[model samples]
Target: MTFVITRPCCNDASCVSVCPVNCIHPTPEEPEFRTAEMLYIDPETCIDCGACVDACPVGAIFPDDELAEEDEPYLRLNADYYLDHEVDAGEPKPVRTPKLPEGEVHVAVVGAGPAAFYATEELVRHPSVHVDMFDRLPTPYGLVRAGVAPDHSATKSVERTFSSTARKKNFQYCLGVTVGEDITHDELTERYHAVVYASGASTDKRLGVDGESLPGSVAATDFVAWYNGHPDHADDAFDFSSARAVIVGNGNVALDVARILLTDPDDLASTDIAEHALDALRSSAVREVVILGRRSIADGAYTNSEFLSMRLVDGVDVVIDADDLELGDELARQVSEGSVDSTIGSKVRLAREYADHGAQGADKRFVFRYLTAPTRILGEDRVTGVRVVRNTFDADAGRIVPTEETSDIATGLVIRSIGYRGVAVDGLPFDDAAGVVPNDAGRVVGDDGVHVPGHYVAGWLKRGASGGIGTNRFCGQETASSLIADIIAGSLPAPTGSRDDVAGLLASRGVEPIDSTGWAAIDKAERDAGRASGRPRRKIVTVDGLRAAAGG
Candidate 1:
């Protein structure tokens, strides 16, 4: 049977490289690859060799007949892509490792996230290359361990690839070492042939509306971190005393927040969700989540996969108002006629179906409201409500504008999931307005517009916060290529000190960096604890706890 690409597909393109017949659409070489929600396999061209099933890092591919009841829709979804777009079954391209500088090329990568792992994966392919990866946290896998919703365990499986990379003899972990605080950027450049920064966007975008800084209103980033057991937010106390929570954006993250609020706490108990967050969820008074969008349903930012998943939650009713889909006569007609991209058409269609189904008196409600923008958050002490204004899509300017009508939504909590903003790396020149390090093709550029030698960046920090977990593969590869090219040209400076010297410096500073063995001990401790509780793993959610688990 032909394989179906299902939800949680990270678009890492590993499957694309292994497909013997090149059945996957939107290969990394294609323009649509950047925007594709998930890669689709062309059923007509399939040899059904199961190469993609093995290559898929996230385990998103499965035989059509083997799909779970909830994922059966993907069988049709994969075929639908080929209906609209033609497939070129060209000779499949194999994954290749680029040749690097012959001698030992030492590199230091900051941040232990997907980008950092992917960059390290590329760098360690050479026999003589050694990488020292650093992270501020005691544990690794920054967002994969901390940002992804707990329910998405398949997405977390990409950690297996990262684990393999970490096992390479040429790679070493320097966990719990904060670059700026423990070691300066200048020191990193002085100690390694090249320094790659893969630290992801750490902060969230704000509503900038009045009362946004109030206690009840919080960034979705912090909430995700809190729930996912990021040590930084493990002790966070969320006021779920309110029956209704309003999320002020309609991206996948906003949906994730809504799902977490509405999902049965028992359903999450087996997952890696933090114990404190789980207890809070079990006692949460939240019953309804209202997700607001500034534009029409056709222009919503969330992907079709996420939208579909919302409907399948066990006890939650997905609500959509018919009025929200009534864009002007012309625009509505375009959506109905499937004149827009297939993904957008599917979202509008799904929304209309939900509107027709109406609310089913479920225990929890997920409400979607379009053409609305928050003018201000309401309350004196904490968020009691939000003052929102009606909006209309101005076709000419291609933007949404506020209308005269206004309404107040009474909600005790407000979550802004607008987007993530990259925090400035300690010594890197940053564009404060854009929330990204100023770089040209992964090379860090200074305010004077000159490339800073031996310094590079990848992932969200390099190109704002966009794309999913797998997108970092291409990003990391690009940055690694730039570093390798510089090394070949002798543009990078020679290292003044050895790895032993850096270790001595850390020891002098009273910083005991966790190596791969130490992290493995922490991993085993967490898994052992999780086994007793029948969970994936009970995450060690504090620096001291993690260190103790690692036998530090």
Candidate 2:
């Protein structure tokens, strides 16, 4: 019987490492693993030992007979790889390591996000290797804890894996450490054999329109951070007094923000959402959230899981234009006709259900507005409304083209969730147009055409903004492989001194980094604080609070 890998696989490849016969085609070490949309097991070579089934963290694996009718497609998807390729079962294969190493190496990874955590995990595999992980925030996991919507707790489970990796003695987490401001690139390079920058894109891409700078206008990134209790955004205020709000994007983040505003405050109170934001949301008067997409519904950017979660949220109305719901192209037709279960199909089903309920002028409405471009923000001081231009779908070009016909939508608050842009790290060569460090695979590329030796990047900083949390595992593996190759090639530079020397240098420069024990204290404090409130864990949302929790 065939075993299928479903969408929930998350690309973490936890199953790949556990297959005794190396039956998993794209092991994390394989070159194809980097680009494969998802992992596939070679059915022909399978011993059906069910080792992979037991190893999967997200329950993405299923036997053929047990496969749900909707997931039956994956059975063939798993078998297709073996049909085109030959598998030598008699040949001896090297055992795979969930952890592997190249040699004696010292590495410093910036940021404690998923990317950094994965890099550290890979780096610590070496018997003689050590890693120093840095983050500006006192706590780590970047967006996993801060940017992810509270309702998506399953997504945040990645943190437990990250926590497990952080426990490695070789992996040192340096929290509350600002790279450019506190410690310079030169200093880090002087202390480690190589430095991997996993610091994710921190800024939001702006919409260059009038009234976007109004008082009530805010970037969805900051709003997300505020509600998630990100220390940087703990005190930031989001005005939800307006009965109607406009969200200018069609991505998962837009859906996340909309659901957060509309979800029952009582439901959120039990989650890890910041107490301050919870209090604000409890009193929120927001009744309608208009999610605007410049392109047609077909081009909207939320995944199936995210869209389904939004639809399943209680006490919210989702509206979609019936005319605009027509399938656009061959892929869209396939999805609409039920040949595939794409995210758009889920959205269409959800939209139809909401449409069937009929529009009630009073209850909260999540209007999914398609083919609209915000032309101007209409307000004197604070946001009162927005001017929008009608957009026509350019099917040939596969984009939205704005038209002269314009109209106004009454909105008290405006949230731009357009996109995320990476900021330049000091002393690193950044491609302003791409909003990333110019890198070849994983090596940092300089403007003068020389490769920056031992400097690397992964995740959103290496690849453009894309993929889910598990995507970073492969991204980080690639970066780590490149780093290991450089070390094996004797191209990586050696650290000038020991960890003590590095810490002394930073302290001399008036910069103090919280160590592992310190981070543990902070973690305990957050958990204890959450326990006090009957929630999962309330984060320490400020530098001072984090420092104090860390026993400073």
Candidate 3:
């Protein structure tokens, strides 16, 4: 029997590399990888070598006969992917590890997130190279724990892969430490040959509207972090008691917020949503959510898979206005001229279908309003409503130009989910406009048009905040390759000594680093607490709590 990829895929795509015969659909190379809820295996092309089963970090794959009774639908899901789509059973390429230097290599990776883990994985492939990862949080796997929507449990399972990466030989984790604060750039440069910064975009783009600072108005990033139990946002509060909430963006984050606000609290009992957030959602008076997008379907950042995913939310209904679903002449021309793929067409079709078939007596609903930009949040102290202007697409300028027409959506809460931008690193050169560290490929670029010696970047910090988890794999490889090439060229000077010296130095400086073993204890504590409540893992949202759980 063939294997099926179940819900916990998390879209890491590690399985694709290990399979001798490629059977997974919507690989990272394809557009489908962006929004696919989870990757599906083509049962028709399955040789059952069991490589995918082993590579899957979340244990999402199972032999057709071995699937639990509740997961029987996934068997069909896997088979159905093949029924409608073409399969390419291409042979796998030979596994290649980077050529390394003779002696031991030491690298310090700032930010113990997906990109850092992927880079760590790449570095450890060479037996001589060792990696010491640093992060501000006591926990590892940065945004996988704090940014991803908790209801999307499958997406969060990528942490399992990272946990495995932490166990590799010569791998070290120094949690609850900020690089610029606890350890300076000069210190790291003196201690290691190279440093790879995977520090993610920590802030969200503003709505740029007046009254955005109203108590009822919040950034989607903060809201996301708050709901996911991030320590930084642990004490943040939201006015979910509002009857209707308005979201001023239509990306995946907007969709996630709408889904979470409207979802039945009973469903989240099995998920890992923060306890306070869970209570907030359960007590929420919100029943209708309005998601506003300034751009048309053709230019929107979210993909077809995400649009389709919205329709699958249990009990919640999607409301697509007929006018919004109707594509403009410019968008239609772009689609016909092949400027964009059929993905937009698929999204337009789904919108039309939902518009045609209105909400079927569902208590909760989400209304998607396109081509509208928020002008201001209407409020005195807290948000009372939002004023928006009709936006006309300026194809020539490739921007949305505001029209004279203005309107208002009455709601107590307004959430801006426009986008995210990275925080500035102390010594790293940052391009403020792009909100990323200036880099050519993966090498950090300085104002003098020279590569920053022994400095590199990967993930969102290298590029602006975009792409999924697997996207970091390629990015990490490129940065790792560059670092390796630099080492071979003898450009990057080695550290004075090994990690023992560095460890002692940290101790003398009063920096108490949390090692991988301590992290494992924290993991067990979280899981154990979650088991008591029949949930995934009850997250530790405070620094003290996490440290205690980590046995600090």
Best by the TM-score measure: 1
Model 2, range 1-552, lDDT digits (tens) per residue? Answer: 757776455677777767777787666556655555567777777777788887776677888789776666566556655554455443335645444344557788998988888877777777677888999888888888888888766567667778888888788878888898888888888878898999999899999998788999999999999999887788898788889999999888999999998889999988999889999998999989998888766667875445545555677766777765544566566765666433345556655665676565536778888888899999997999989987885689866678788999998899999989898888899988999999887899899878899799988888867765667888887798888778767888777765558777778887788988999998899889889988788877789988998988
Greater-TM-score candidate between 1 and 3: 1
Q: What is the C-alpha lDDT of each candidate?
A: 0.89, 0.79, 0.81
Clashing pairs in 1: none
Task: Give the lowest summed-lDDT range of ten residues in model 3.
Answer: 338-347
Which order, best to worst by TM-score? 1, 3, 2
* Among all candidates shown, the one with the greatest lDDT: 1
For candidate 3, the TM-score is: 0.89
Error of 2 at 124 (Å): 0.8
TM-score per model over all chains: 0.97, 0.86, 0.89
Instruction: Write model 3 residue lDDT over 1-552, tens digit each, in one string.
Output: 898876556677889888877888777667666556567888778898999988887677899999776567566556655554675789866666657658877899999878888888878878788899999899898888887787777677777778777888789898888788777888898888888999889888997779999899989999989889999888998987788999988787888888888888888768899998998888899989999988876556764456766777788888877876535667777656645444565566567778999888888898998888898899897899999888876767866788899988889989899888998899888889999999887889999989988899999999888876767766777688888888778888767655567667778888788998889999899999999999978988899999998887
**Stretches of candidate 1 exceeding 4 Å from the true structure:** 328-330
Stretches of model 3 off by over 4 angstroms after superposition? 1-11, 21-54, 58-89, 333-340, 394-399, 496-498
Q: RMSD, model 3, all Cα superposed?
A: 3.7
Clashing residue pairs in all predictions, respectively, total 0, 0, 0
Deviation (Å) of 522 in candidate 1: 0.6
